[model samples]
Target chain A: MLPNRSRTSVLVFLLPPLLLYCAAVLFPILQSLFLSFFSWNGISDMEFVGLDNYVRMLTADDIFWRSFFNALLYLAICLVLQLGGALVVASLLTSLRRGRELIKTLYLLPAVISTVAIAFLFVRIYSIDPVGLLNQLLHWIGLGTFERAWLSDVNTVLAAVSAPEAGGSPGCTCSSSTPR
Target chain B: MKKLFRAAAVAAAAALALSACGGVGAASDPANVSPTGEIKPREISWLLSRPADGAVINIMKKLADDYAKDHPGFALNLITTPDRPSYIQKLETLAAANKLPELFDTDATPFAQQLAKQGKMVDAEKLLKSLDVYDDYRPGALDYQRFDDGSLYMIPFQFELEFIWYNKALLEKAGVTVPKSLDDLPAMCTALRSAGITPIAIDGQDQWPLERYVAYQPFRAAGPEFVQKLKKGEATFTDPAGQKTVKWMAELGKAKCFQDGFSAQGYSDAQNQFTSGQAAMYNIGTWELPSLATDKLNSEVRDDIDFFTLPTTDGSVTSANEFVSPSGIGMAVNSKTYDPLVSDFLKFALAKYPAEYAATGALSPTTTVQTTVPANATPLYKKALETADTLGAKQAMPWDTQLDPTTNGRLQQELVLLVQGNITPEQFTSTMDNTIKQNAPKFFK
Candidate 1:
C-alpha cells in the first residue's frame, strides 16, 4: 500500500542484502551441484564423469548407504527427543507456579555449554574402564549386569552418540515453545 | 517497476563478476623449486602434529632459537595440533589449497606419495645427501619414510620401538609366563583373566592402536611384503597371511585379552590402567619410557614393570627383532617455500638435533647419537635402547599408513567389530578384500 516513490526506496534499501544472499548462499549451492558432475581430488584436474559419481554412490558404495541410513536414524531420534521432549517440558513449565525461572535456567544449562565439552563429558560418562558415573550408578543399584560400554558396543553406539546431540539442544526448543 | 528490475539485474551481474574474480584469485600457481633464489632471512612456519610439550617439539624449539641467534631476522613459527584426526583434516585442506607452510609433519601414507608425485614435497634423501648428513640417519628410520618405490620425501626425526610392557608381579600372581610367540598370547591372556586380572590395556578409542594389533600376525606370517602387496591389490585379505591375522585377532577377542570396554578407553586411561597395576600388560612404544621405565611411574607398580619384544609365531617369516619400530611421523619440506636460508637453517638444526634430542632421554633417528638415559631411569630403559641396535632389517609397516584412506578407515571400524565379536573373521576378510579391490587402484595408480 506504499506510494510509488517510497516503494522504490524500500526496494533500493533491500537490494544490497539480497545480492549478498545470492552471492554467499545460492552461489555455493550452485557450485557444489556443478562440481557433482566431476571427479577431482582437490589438487588434481577435474574430470567430467557425467552421472557416474551419483550412480556409484547410490548403487555400488555400501558405506554410503550405511551412512545414509545412520543419518536417517539420527534424524528420527533427534525429532523424538528434541521436539517431543521440548514440548513435554514446555507444557510442564507453563503449569508451574513458582521456581519456573530456576528450572528453565537449569534445563538451558547444557544448551549454553560448548559441544566439544559436552562430548568429552558424555565420553567420560559412557566410559567403563575407569567406572564412569553411569556404570557406578548401575552397580550401586545392583544392576551391574546391564552395565556395558555404551560408546563402544555396536548395538548401543549409534544411540549413544545420538543421545548427546538430542539432549544438548532440547532446552532451546523448550524455551521457544513455552508460553510467554 | 521496470527500472527497479533493471537495477536488480545489474546488481546480480556485478555480484557474479566479483565471485568470478574471487575464484580467479584462489587459483594459485603450482608449487615449484626456485633453486637460484637468494636466501631470505624471514619467519618460517612448521605445522606439526606432535604435542606442544613433547621432546621433539622441545628440542626443535631450542634449535630454532639457537639458529635465530645467528640469523638476526629469522623466526621459527611452530603451529602444533596434537590431535591426529583433526590435524589430518587440516593438513589435507591446506594441501588442497596449495597453502602448506614451509615445513609440515606427515606419515609416509599414500596421500603423502601423491604430494611427492605432484612435486609439492622436497626429496628428503637428496636434501640430506646435499647436507652431508645422509649416512648419519638410522637405516630403519630412513626405511620407514620411504615409499613403495623406495623414494624418500620425508625426514625422520625420532625413533621408537613398540613393546609389550607388562607388570612382573601381576604375571607372577596369574602364574603366566611371558609369551614367546604370537600364538602364546591368548593362552597368557586366559591365564591372567582366570586370575581375575585384566589381560591387556589398549587405547582402542584412537582406533590406530587396534589396527596395530591387526598388523602383528601378518608381519610374522608373511613379513612386510604381505601388506605392501595387499595395499596395491596384488594381494588380498583372504590370502594366508591376512587370514592368519584376522583369525588371531578373533582369538584374542575370545580370550578376553583386552580389558572390558577397552575400545571406549582413551590413551591416558589405558596408560593409567597399566601404571596403576589394574591391567597386566600394555602394548606401547618407547615414547612412553620416560613414564614406564622411570621412577615417574606409580610407586606400587614401578619395580614390577618390564617389557618384552613382539613375540614370534609358528612358521614365522619375520624374526623376533623385526616388529613395529617406527621413526614417528616424518617432517616434509615444502618445495615451493624452500630457499637457501631454509636449507642453511636445516643444516644447522639437523646437526644439533640428534645430540640434543638424545640428551633428553628420547631416541633420535640418527645412528651416530645415543640416548642419555636419565639417572632415575630403570634398567629396563637401558635394555630397550640396547635392543634397538640389534633390530632386524624388516619392519612391520603400520597398515593405517599403507592402505588407502577409505579402506584404512573401513578396516579400523571392522577391526573393532571383529575384536568385539560383532563380526566373524570370514566376514572381516571378505569385506576388507572387497574394499581393497575397489579402492586401491584409485589411490595407488
Candidate 2:
C-alpha cells in the first residue's frame, strides 16, 4: 500500500542504527584486530609490528600452549556433559509418572545453586581419605577400592572439576578433584 | 513521507547512543584541575582483590577517610571482590574498555605483571620517590612490587612469611613436640595418628597452598640457594628435595590427617578449623593473626595455637625458607593523574599507612610501627618476624609474580595434575618443561 518513496524513507531510517552498531561493536573489534599486531602497551605510542603477539603466544610461550590445551580439554567435557546429561536425564524422566515433579525438581537442584556452593559440596563428597561421604558410602557398599583424593593431583583434576556438570559428584580423590 | 519520518527518528537515537559513551560526567573528567593545579574534589575509584569483610579493607577504608579529611579535594572509590579469578577477569575487562579505578590492590600474581608489561599501570617508582616514605616500608616488600629490570608498578602492603602452626593441646596429648625441622615431621605425623588424632589439617583444594608446600622443600634441602636456582632455571622441581615435598603431600593423604572435606573448604574455613582445635597443625602464612585471635574457641583450645618455622631437611641446619611474597598489596596512581596531587597522596598514604594498617590486622609491616599483639597472637607470629628479618632478600620478585601469564597458567593446571598421581615425579618435571616449551619457548630460553 506504501509508495516507493515511503520504502526509501524506511531504508534511510534504518541506516543510522546500522551505522552506529558498526561503529560501536564492530569498530572496536576491528580495532583490537589491528592493535593486536603491535607490541605497544596501552599507554605508549603504538608502532606497527606484525602478528607478534599471536606468533609469540603460539611459538614462544609454552605455558600458554599448555593452558590452551587444558582449556580445550575442558571445553570438550562441557559439550559432552551438557548434551549427554540432558539426553540421559530426559530419557530417564520418561520412565517416571508419579512424583515426576519432585524427581524433576531434585534433578534440577544443582542448576539452581551457585557454582561456588556446588563446588564445595562436591569437595566433601570426594575427599581423599575414607572420610568423604563418597568414600564412606563406597566402603559401606564394599566399593572402597575406587576411593582417592579427587582434587589434589593433575591426572583427575579435570574430571573432578567437570564432574558436577556430567551428572557425577564433584571433587577429585588422591584424589585431587581438579578442573572446576 | 512516513518512512522519511522513521529514518529521522532512527538517526536521532543513534546520535544519542554515540554520545552516551563519552563524559560520564565532570566527576570522571581527566582535566579540571583545582587552584593548586591538581584535580579538585575528585573521587578516585580503587578496584581490589580482597573481600569487603577482610581485615585489610576495613583498615584501608578508615585510612582513606582520614586522608580525605586532610585533603578535601580527594576521595577514594573502593571496589573489592573475594573471588580472585573473577577479580582478574574484571580487571582485564575494564582495561579493554579503558575504565579502571583510581587505585586497587593485586598480588604478585602474573596477571598483575601483565597489566604492567602491557602498560596499563602508571610507573610506581616516580610516585614512590615522590611519596618520600618509600624506604620506610619493610625493605623487601616494596621491591616485591617491582619488575626485574627495576620498574616500580605497585605498592606492597605486607611481608607474608609462610610457616607451620601447631596445636599445643593435640601435640601435647600425643607427647610430641613441634618439629625443629622437616625431617622430624614424618615421625610427628605418625605419633599424632597413633594417638588417635590427625597430625595436620591441610586445605588441599586450594592449589597454591600446595605449591608453597612443594616449592619450600627445595629451599629446605639446599638452603635459600635453591630458591635462587629455581628462579634462574638451574633447578627443577624434580630434584630429590622437591620430590620429598611432593611425597609428603601424598603421605598426608595416606595418613588421613585432614578433615572430611579439606579439599573443599575455602581458605578461611580451613584456618578456622585449626584455630578451633579440630586439627593439630596447619602450615600457613602470617595474615591469619586477626582470625586466630578472635576465633570462637574455648581458652584451652585457643591457647593451643602456636607456630614453628618449617624444619630442617638436609643436615646443615637446613631451615626451610618461608614463602615470603614481596611486600603486600601495592598502590598505583592513574598516569593521567595530575602529578602534584598524586605525589601528595602518595606521601600521605605511605607516611602512616603501615602502622595503621598493622594496627588494624595485628600485622605491623612497618619497622617503625611497634604493633602490640592482642593478649593471644601466638608467639609464633612474633617469632616469624625475627625469621623474616633474616630472610635471604626482602625484594626479590616472587616466582608466582614473575612468571609470564602463559607459563603461569600452565603451571597451575599441571600442578593440580602432578599431585594427583596423574604423572610420575619425573613426568611432573618434564611436563612442566614441555608445557612451557609448547606455550612460551622464548621466556624459558
Candidate 3:
C-alpha cells in the first residue's frame, strides 16, 4: 500500500498548503502586528510610535478595559450555562420517554434564528414603556417594583445582551447520540 | 501507489485554490467605458440605509418606478440594511474588498473622510457643478461632510433642524407657556412634573440627542467656532463655555426633567411616550415631522403638538432663531465605478428626487423644492412649514458629525453616564477634551 519515496516527496506535498495558509491568514496577521506600532488612521501615512498604541489603550482607554472585563464575564457565563447547563439538560433529556424530539426541536429554535433577529427580539423584550415581556413577567409575579429598563441601565445592559447568547444555548441535545 | 497519487492530487488542488484568488474579476475596469463616451446600458446597485418602509424609501421607490418607465434598459437595484450600524459595517466591508456599490450613503466621520482621501469616493463638488445645481443646495448644508482640504464627497439630501415639540394642551394644563429662554425650561419642567406628567421624552439611548442637548449652551455662548476649535485642540472643555453647558445638562438630569428611566428609552419608545400623552415634551429633529403630523398613533394628540426653537441660554451670543441644522444622509458615488451609467443614473435621480420627496411632505435639502403645506393640513405640519422660513444663518452642526470618530464615540457613552449620575459634569467634559486632544494629531492633521 506504500510507494518507495524520499523525504523530499513529503516536503513537496506539504509546501503548497503551508504557503497558501501563510498568504491568506498569517500574512495579514503579521501585517497588523507591524502596523500596530504606528499611529495611523488607516488611510493616512503612518507615524512610527512604538508601543504607544498599547500604552494608550492600557492607561487611558477606560472603555477598552470595561469591554475586556465584560468579555471575560461573558465567557464565564457562557462556559457555565452553555457547556455545563447543556450537559445537565442532555442528561435530563436522555432520561425522558415522551415527546423528547419535539422538546429538543423547540429548544433549538433560537440557534436557528439570525443573530440580528435575536438582538431585535431582545430589544423588544427590554423595552420600558408598554412593558417589555421580561418586565411584564416580573409584574405578573408581583414583582412590579423590581422592573427596570434592562438595556438602558448600565448595571443591566451587559446582562441584557448576554441573555441572547444564553437563550441560544440548545443544551447539547444534538449530542445525545454520543456515548460516555 | 494509490496513497501516493492521492497526496499528489491534494498538493495540486491547494496550488489551484491559491492561484484562483488572483483570477477573480477586478471591482472596476476602465474597459467598461465605451469608445463613443456614452453610458452603456446596465443596472447599478444602490446600497441604502433607509428602512424598507421608511418615508424616504417610499419616495425613492416612486422615483425609481418613474425612472424605469422612462429609461428602457437602465435600472437601479436598491439594497437595504436593517439598521444604521449594520449598514455602515456592510459598506466598510465592501470597501475593504474593493466591491463598494455604485452609490451609497454614510455619516460624516473620519471613516468617510478616509474614503475620500483614498480617492474611493467621487468628488461630489465636481459632479454637482457639472449638473449646475451645486448652488441650489442650502448654504452650509454640505459643511458637515467636507474634508480638511475642503473637498466635498457626498450629496446631501434632507436638511434637518432640531427643536422641542410640546403638547400644547399638556403645557396649558400645567399653567406653563412656551419657554422664551433656556433659563425658563427648568421652571417649566418643574411645573409639568408637579402636574404628574413627564416633562420631556428624549431618546437618551440614541446619545446624539443628549450630545446636542449638552452642546446648546456652549454653542450659544461661544458661537459655532467653539466645536471646530475644540476639535483642533485649540480649546478645552475646561473653558467657561464648555463647563457652562455640562453644568446645565447635569442640573436638568438632577431635576428629573426627562421621563423616568429616560436613559434606557429608545427613539421609537420616547416618541411613543410623547404621542400617547404620557409625556409633555419631545425633543428631536425636523425628520420627526412626518410622524408628528400624521402618524395614526398620534390621532388624539395630533391637534395639541407644536414646537419651540431651542431657547436662549445665559451669555448666548446668537439669538433663539439659530438652531442645529445640518444635512441628513447624503449619497456618494464609488470612485472606481465600473459602469458609466452609475453616474448617469445619479444625475437623473437627483434632478427628480427633490420634487418627488416634497410630494411626500418631507423637506428636500435643495433650495428649489418649494414647500406648500396643504390648506387642510394639521396644525403641526403648518407650524413646521412656517418655521422653515425662519431658519437662521448660524446653524450648528450636530456634535457627532463634527467630532472625530474615536472622540465622538467615547463622548456619546460618557455623556450617557454623566446623565445617569455615575460621573460628574467636570469628568464628562475632561474626558471629551482629552479624547479630542489624543485623536487630533492622527485625524485632524
Q: Which candidate is the best by DockQ?
A: 1
- For every candidate, the chain B TM-score is 0.93, 0.78, 0.86
Each candidate's DockQ: 0.45, 0.15, 0.22
In candidate 1, what are the lDDT values of residues A1-180, reduced to their tens digit? Answer: 566658769778887897788779876666677668877655555668999999999999988999999999999999999999999999999999999899999999989999999999999998887778998999999999979999888888899999999998899999999877
TM per candidate comes to: 0.93, 0.72, 0.82
Q: Model 1: clashing residue pairs? A: none
Q: How close is candidate 2 to the true structure, as a TM-score?
A: 0.72
Model 1 residue B373 lDDT score: 92
I-RMSD for candidate 1 = 3.5
The reply for model 3, stretches above 4 Å from the true place, is: A1-31, A87-118, A124-127, A133-145, A173-180, B1-41, B53-73, B93-102, B114-123, B140-151, B295-297, B334-347, B372-376
Residue B128 accuracy (lDDT) in model 2: 56
TM-score head-to-head 2 vs 3, winner:
3
Q: Write the residue-wise lDDT of candidate 1 on B1-445 in tens digits.
A: 6776687567666655553333111322223322556667899999999988998898888889998888889999999999988998899878876788999999999999988887788888888988899999999999999999999989998999999999999999999889988899989999999998999999988999989999998898888998999999998888888888899999999999998888878899899999999999999999999899888999999889999989998899999999999998999998877887888889999999999999999888998887899999988899999989999999998888898888999999899889999999999998999899988888887
Residue A109 lDDT in candidate 1: 92
**Global lDDT of each candidate:** 0.88, 0.61, 0.75
